[model samples]
Target: KSKFGTDLNEVPREISFCSHTITGNKAHVVPDLSKDSRFVDHPLVVSGPLARFYAGVPLVTADGYGVGAVCVLDTVPREIAPAQLSGLEAIARQIMSHLNSRNLLESERQLSTQLSQSKRQLDDFFDLATDFLGICDINGHFIKISHSFLKVLGYSEREFIYKPFTDLLHPEDVEQTINGFISLESGVQLGLSNRLRAKNGRYVPLSWNLSSNVDGLVYAVARDMTKQYELEKNLIQAKEKAEAAASAKSRFLANMSHEIRTPMNGIIGMTSLLKGSIDDEVNIERLNIIQSSGDTLLELIDDILDFSKLEVDKIEIEKQALSVRETIQDVIGLLGTKASQKDIAVKYIQSKSVPAWILGDVTRFRQILLNLLSNALKFTERGSVEISSDATPTDDGQWTLTFAVKDTGIGISQENIAKLFTAFTQEDASTTRRFGGSGLGLAICKGLCEKMGGRIWVESYLGQGSCFTFTFNALETTASTEGRKKDPFAQIPTDLGSVKPLRILVAEDNRTNQIVISSLLKKVGYTPVLVFNGAEALELLEKECFDVILMDCHMPVLDGFQTSKAILQKFSDNRRPYIIALTASTQKVDIDLCFSSGMDGFLSKPITVNPLFTALDEVYSKIHDQVPSDRPIGIDKNVSLTRKQSKKQD
Candidate 1:
């Protein structure tokens, strides 16, 4: 603007000289634009810088897209010397060169501005991020930590940097945190929760998001999880407390069950002993009622305890040889009286395909059948309850035994059938009231069936009846369950009076129980020397030899378990008496304990004549086996023969 007369910097593209020159590949020279038809009507030519002399060249980039142009314009037409004209062209090239250089400088300035802004944004993000950002070396040492890290954990950069990341973690978390570094290079990892020790020596839970930087560094963003962790801890503690309360309740139930059964054993035993002596019909009828009531109470107790055990996963099913036919027949025999009274005939159907014996839990197996059959009988007024079993052999040397209990009774609606096997749910309220049951039998059966690798279901229609079926997979056993199980009283005389009485030591503490047990022994023609506890029994055994020792598992001073162990250790095997454990505990663990502790036999109490007689019979049979056939029978009269057998073999 200083050198030229005026400036047309604001001119429109229509009459712009720079725009016209940009269309040409090189300089355009017009001595007078008004003489050219293209610019004759142009505004700049006709109105302002009129009759212009123009010399212009395009401002071309390196890629050759012309953005603008530089030109010299004069108000009047002019002619120059040839030398001056050539000089002007050279000057125009120089102008283009300057224009290119100016554009380059301007682009560099824009790029510099962009880079500065980008850096500012990145720095802002790094310092102000909500997550605790950090960079660690491959060795897990902190190289740099964001201000958020210091803010979140209350640690200064000097105090945190260069220290191992694991050093800041909770002691228990160190190993796991360190292990994460080795494989982190594979990909980004996030949302891993860990406990970190803060500067103030308090634990801060952090959920981390991490990734591997191409340059041997670990980048991490950690979110504070202390509150979430505390909530989870509270939930866990509540769960633990609930579990503890449940465990205590179970313990109380088991103890109470043991405690209650002890007295009931005495009562049932006394009742059994007195039943035959009572001649009055009314007294006999009353005794029957008492026994039935006691039995029902026993069933209820058993159901409650069994269900509790199942709930706790404490029930263990044994894998052993079991007889399906015999087990079913036995159930039928036990329930025969009830079935006869109701005039509902029961039948057992078995296909020849079913194996004689299979490996399974015999107790649970029988329980399943008993529950289904008993349920069938309760519903059926007069129709038959048919229990059938058939098995299909499996590829793994096993058999799938499908059992069904079909019955005719007030059939369940489709909706109610689903509720049948659930605990405390029977057909209906009226049915439960009239039929009389705890409604836990089928639930227990279902639990037992599932535990034994089987499933149970029912098919029924209204007014028609119900058929309850279950399938069990069992491994074939070479030995028969019945053949291997000998009748304990088959060889022994049940009339204890007929057989000569053996010298017996009864370890019992309760006064009433002592008299009752002694009376029963006396009635059976055996004189028992009763000791108050295991210590008393031990003391008595030191001085005298007895043919049999009836030990109560739980007593005041030194229970039966300890006493039996002491007796076995003290006496030579050949001289040891046949020890039988008398316990009110029908728990499998307790029975297993009795046998494992080397008792000759187990007799669960409220001891009826049958159990007592069976224990005695088994004891005698075991003694007979222990006695060496080669040795003189008198050498070891009625005790386990020692391995040495010094009296005879030596």
Candidate 2:
């Protein structure tokens, strides 16, 4: 081994496994071999090819703890600079930093893979959830629908995404939900339980809870309420049937009261006049007592029917041209009388912007206002009732004429205010006992206001009085045209020509009703041919071409349906005689049947002369194609129906 390095050209060759040594780590350096005794006698030191000046450092760990290093080599002994050694040290530090970074990166890669796996599991769980999840934009277009929602609706996510949320809702619920959603967007929360149509065209109930995500985005959770809703609906239907029977009984009572008092109105009126004619004060007092009792009975009947109609949802919106100011005046006048009796003053403020003409269901609006004002009057023994109205623009390019009826009366408690609009409810049971009412007045008012596309609310303090405010969206029209078309009850003729009497056919089974209808026809200057049943009426129609046929339903020989069908088949021509239905039934199914059978119109049973005339005018006048002749021009049914006669008087 000592002679191994003796050859000048021979080199000691050994290979190291660590690759870092490949890059200059094997280089050798020898400095001042002449001064070194260790190499003085060595042949390698004297005659070897490159081992003269040796200076080396071991390459170490990545922390710069040296294991090995590069060295310089030369045949002759030479000096190396301190600056060069510092440069080599800097290179070693660079290599160490690189190796350490690589080791740390590999550790992070493994951790990231584990985290990704965990996230995938969570996503899978959400995908498998039973409750449906969905997200929608503010415009109500679906951004995403859960697999469960798609499965329930029989649709794919591809089909539902980007579609309007309202598209899946039942047609009747679409507007309501949309309106609710709009309110929600304005910081209101909407928890909706509504009907949604399935692909098979059946409706299923869905409950939804929604939260706003980012701007203009909403995340919603929904659950299928089909089974629960079905049970609820069945229960509702049962309740509705029971309510309908009760309503019918109430209506029967009202009818009896109306029929008895109708003649009694004449009797009481005549008897009172008779008592006046007589010089006996005792008889007069007795007659006054009798009239008062009848009046009280009539009032009681009205209260019962109002409550029943509200419960059963039988009230329909009736349109008439009414003077807005006049209606308020009438309500105020009635309240003012009560207020005066209590030594309280009543004031009405009319805003200048309030239009003389308006389009609305007059009877309902007036009833609502009247109920509120009367409540105010009843509660306040010594305070004023103020009715006022003003016009303003609604956001939808429409105008709202708001009516507020404020009263300095016994204010309502905050807790009881919410219950005021509930059916058969007052401030409390005690309130109903103290005040004479069925407790359904405010409920009717709420329903009526909503039907008219308005809302009623109240603001009050406990000791101070209350203010009832309502907003109505009224259709606008030109003043001249409004005045000309407003009146529905005016007697002015469409044409000045002497009119021939209409040959009308009256189909009725009841003898008293037949005579009553005949008398009404005679009063209207029309000669009507009376038939005992629908079959007889149909036979009469075939025998002679009548101007109109007033068909009654539920006859012995044939019902209104069969008779209508037979008549329709016979008169297949487009220009058939007007078939007006006279029926006690006002069910949706019944009305739809009449419409489908080509009936021109329907009149409710126990028809008065006014409604009968109105229906006839609506049918016969529509056929005339010009202005309706029976109802005169410039005579608004609305104003007359809602406004006081005194308000219209010059």
Candidate 3:
């Protein structure tokens, strides 16, 4: 072909001689292009540039792709030497090697730029994070620390770097910190907490999470726990203070109850004794007034104590078989005097669905009815009060009984009904002034109803009477109702001539209480030996054998509990006297304590003729081996009759 120029550089592959060389792995040589059959019609030889001789070598890449060729062409036909073709192949390989190397260098430059940008982003993130981030060397030295770590310790980066990590720890925490680091080095992740000494010289609490790599460097994240620790400490202190206050309140209530009930018992007991002997109608009426006022005062004290017990969740519910109708009748009888004074009629209606006997807390049940009936009678000056009861059966074999007390008194307003059940609240300030009350009666009733698995509510309107309703859960029981209706004094003979003898002993420290108890026993044909205190009673017991010992709980010398326990230890079951506890305190805890101290029965004082006769009859029944008509409150009939022989010995 002609001399190489820019115009020939643009030849298309289909008519180009170099295209043939590029198709093979080696050089292509045409000694005479006109004589070669494959190139006989070649464009360059026929017209453009008549070439008689040609030689070319393929420019193959390292991966064996032939892109183009290096060639020599001449117009005159000539034979190509082997040496010449080898020289052309070497030139083609050298050109391919130079192109490959240049492309690789450009790619490496781009990669280096990307890596530099990534490193800058990581450094920015490390400095900007708020959490305390740090790295420690194998020796527990701070090799790297973030800005947050330096700021929290009040130290500059220069002062913290390369410093021992434990240097900032509280003296009490250094040993644990060292152990934690050692654990981290053994491929264990660690969670640690310690107090760190800050620049202000005050120790700051910190919580940390640490991990280690094979490079012997520890990576850590920490949080300042100063506020959290202080909060926890404050919460603990508050809880302790609350417990102390509660304990103090309980002690105060118990003391007040004992002090108040002691005088109340005397007032009521003496009034009862005075009434039995007086024949004048005016004097008897005056005595009744005195007894009624004393009962009102005692009820006020009970309300306060009950509310306090309920507030602290200390009131316990007792399950016993009780007659629903009898219990209601008893409550009605209790308020009957008040109703008579006001000239108001009191009625009770019982539905057939209400079982005769149901399992429940009889005392609390009576208390609820008493509170409701008392309120109704107090408000109704001239109208009638009605109490109705009905029961609904549940699928679980239990019964839900509902009782309602409707009064036609000075009716409550709609707004006042909302506040009726709240403690220390009444209809208004005028109501408190006119109708005196502690305003805790309804609240106590609510608390009692809930304790018995029930709820209480009221419905009323202005100028209309109010209706208070309550519901409780109970199980149907087949308990006998024979003795429950018997008169408590039925066994005591009116004429003392034919009375069975009982050797009774009364141990009371108070002079008035001793006289009142002795006179009551005498009235019932029982002549009891009297003593001043529990110690005196124990002394008398050592010298005499008595059938019954009525022990007062609180006295000057040895208390009744200690005296009872001593008696229990000194005498065998068959020889010990039938001990009965008499106390002014009516708390359940106190009653339980009485029984635990080996007393067979308990009686709350300001003793009256009925309960006093009941207790004596119970003791006599045990002695004579006859089942009395009624058992006294808190008497355990199942107590072994081994003590029966004590009376025979006496």
Q: Which residue ranges in model 2 land beyond 4 Å of their true spot?
A: 1-22, 25-322, 330-347, 393-398, 450-453, 462-464, 478-498, 554-557, 574-576, 584-590, 618-650
**Model 3 alpha-carbon miss at residue 278, Å:** 4.9
By TM-score, is 1 or 2 better?
A: 1
Q: How well does candidate 1 score on lDDT at residue 505?
A: 88
- Local accuracy of candidate 2 as per-residue lDDT tens digits, 426-475: 88777778887877777767777776778889998877999998887876
TM-score of candidate 2 to 2 decimals: 0.52
Descending-TM-score candidate ranking: 3, 1, 2
Candidate 3, residues 178-203, lDDT tens digits: the string is 99988877899999999888788888
- Model-by-model lDDT, in order? 0.75, 0.65, 0.81
Runs of candidate 3 with Cα error greater than 4 angstroms are 1-152, 167-192, 199-201, 210-219, 275-285, 340-343, 380-383, 409-417, 482-488, 493-506, 525-529, 533-549, 561-580, 588-602, 608-650
Cα TM-score per model: 0.68, 0.52, 0.75
lDDT of 1 by residue, 1-650 (tens): 11355654466777676677888757678888889888888887768546578776665767887766655678888765567656656765676687778988999999999999997887788798877888888787888778887887888889888988687788888777777777786665644778888888888888887788788788888888877778999999999999999778777776777777777777776776667576788987787778767776777787888888888776777777877888899889878889999999999999999999888888788777878888888889988999888999888888999999999987888989889889988878998889888888988888888887888888999889999899879988877523532322244354574564467889888776787778777776678899989999888888887867888888887988888889889987667676777776656556667766767666766666656755554454445554342221111122332223322211
Q: By TM-score, how accurate is candidate 1? A: 0.68
lDDT of 2: 0.65
Clashes of each: 2, 30, 0
The C-alpha stretches of model 1 lying farther than 4 A from their native spots are: 1-131, 135-202, 207-218, 271-293, 319-326, 355-362, 475-491, 494-503, 515-527, 545-548, 561-580, 588-602, 608-650
Q: What's the C-alpha lDDT at position 533 in model 2? A: 88
